[model samples]
Target: MMNPAPALPRLAIHYCTGCRWLMRAAWMAQELLTTFEKELGEVALVPGHGGVFRILCDDELLWDRKIDGGFPDIKALKQRVRDRIAPGKALGHSETAAH
Candidate 1:
């Protein structure tokens, strides 16, 4: 018998509802979904407070706004997610952009 395909990774974006960051979270979700449609199984927006903003892949922390000192631009975010899910994968122009 043939083995089934592995389950794709799940990403969660926890944004501060009190801070009104839902739109930002939603946009990030859309971006990740568009970029990693095949690699990612789902992108969930998790409501949070206390100025929280974080991205996680299968419970692995990818980005933490406070800990990281600031929010990552989409290019950096994509690099972070890609490093977690598909290391060494090409990110086209994002790869060439300065860090």
Candidate 2:
């Protein structure tokens, strides 16, 4: 049987106080998008009204919630990113759980 196609992913970045953090986050998110494009396909990271945001698999509420550690928390952000790239699988699933 043919499997259903995975839904398109979406990202939303809530507006924060300054552009420094948001800008950095946006850049990092873009890098992630490029890396995951082969698997998860295209992804988006946008700014909203309170903080930065990113699409989880297809969730658009990532921006609504505050992200801990801010921009420096690339590890945490990457985890959330990996979650979207390979929902059930771990980051770099082919190898160890962590990548």
Candidate 3:
């Protein structure tokens, strides 16, 4: 018998309408989905307020705009998500130098 693979993580991106974070949030979602298509279960866009921009994976908070003092770099965000959901996976150039 072989061991089963872990369940794919669910990512939720919450962006504030008041701050016009839709494009940023959507772009991040697109990048994550494209990069981790097979590893991620889903990426949900959630509307929010008060300059809120957060990324949650499997109900765990991964990034926060206000808390982190600004938006996250897409590559960094990918690493963060990958660390939690697919620790053994490599992000290739995204994790290399010059970033």
Candidate 4:
């Protein structure tokens, strides 16, 4: 018998509370949840500090604001998460728009 596919990954969005990035972090969480509803197990919003903003999947770091030097574009962020969780999935308009 063939083995079943692995379960979906858990996503964590950590944003700097001191920088007041709650809205930005929450918005990205909402976008990811909406786009990958079927493939994601959960999305957690974590409060952080020192202008830190990061996205992690299954404990692996995906994005970091300090390193990237800015907030991620919504569409680009979606594509990055999709690439990890559901590689074959399409992201509709998010994929077509220029970044």
Clashing pairs in 1: none
> What local lDDT does model 4 show for residue 78?
88
Instruction: Let me know the TM-score candidate 3 reaches against the reference structure.
Output: 0.90
Q: Compared with the true structure, what per-residue lDDT tens digits does model 4 show for residues 1-99?
A: 999987779999999999999999998999899999999989999998988899999998889988877889988898889898899999899989566
Q: Rank all candidate structures by their TM-score, best first, as comma-separated numbers.
A: 1, 3, 4, 2
Model 1 lDDT per residue over 1-99, tens place:
999999999999999999999999999999999889889999999999999999999999999999999888999999989989999688888879566
TM-score of each: 0.92, 0.51, 0.90, 0.89
Task: List the candidate numbers ranked by lDDT, top first.
Answer: 1, 3, 4, 2
Selected candidate, larger lDDT, 1 vs 4? 1
Scored by TM-score, the top model is 1
Q: What is the lDDT of residue 50 in candidate 3?
A: 83
Evaluate all candidate structures by whole-model CA lDDT and list the values in order.
Answer: 0.93, 0.52, 0.93, 0.91
The alpha-carbon lDDT assigned to residue 44 of candidate 3 equals: 98
Off by over 4 Å in 4: 1-6
Would you give me the overall lDDT of model 4? 0.91
- Model 2, C-alpha of 51: deviation from truth (Å): 5.2
What's the CA error at residue 35 for candidate 2, in Å?
A: 2.6
Global local distance difference test of model 2 = 0.52
Query: How many clashes (backbone N, Cα, C below 3 Å) per candidate?
Result: 0, 11, 0, 0
| Candidate 2, 1-99: lDDT as tens digits | 999997655544443445445665567667666656656555554555445443344653433234433343455555666665557655553333553
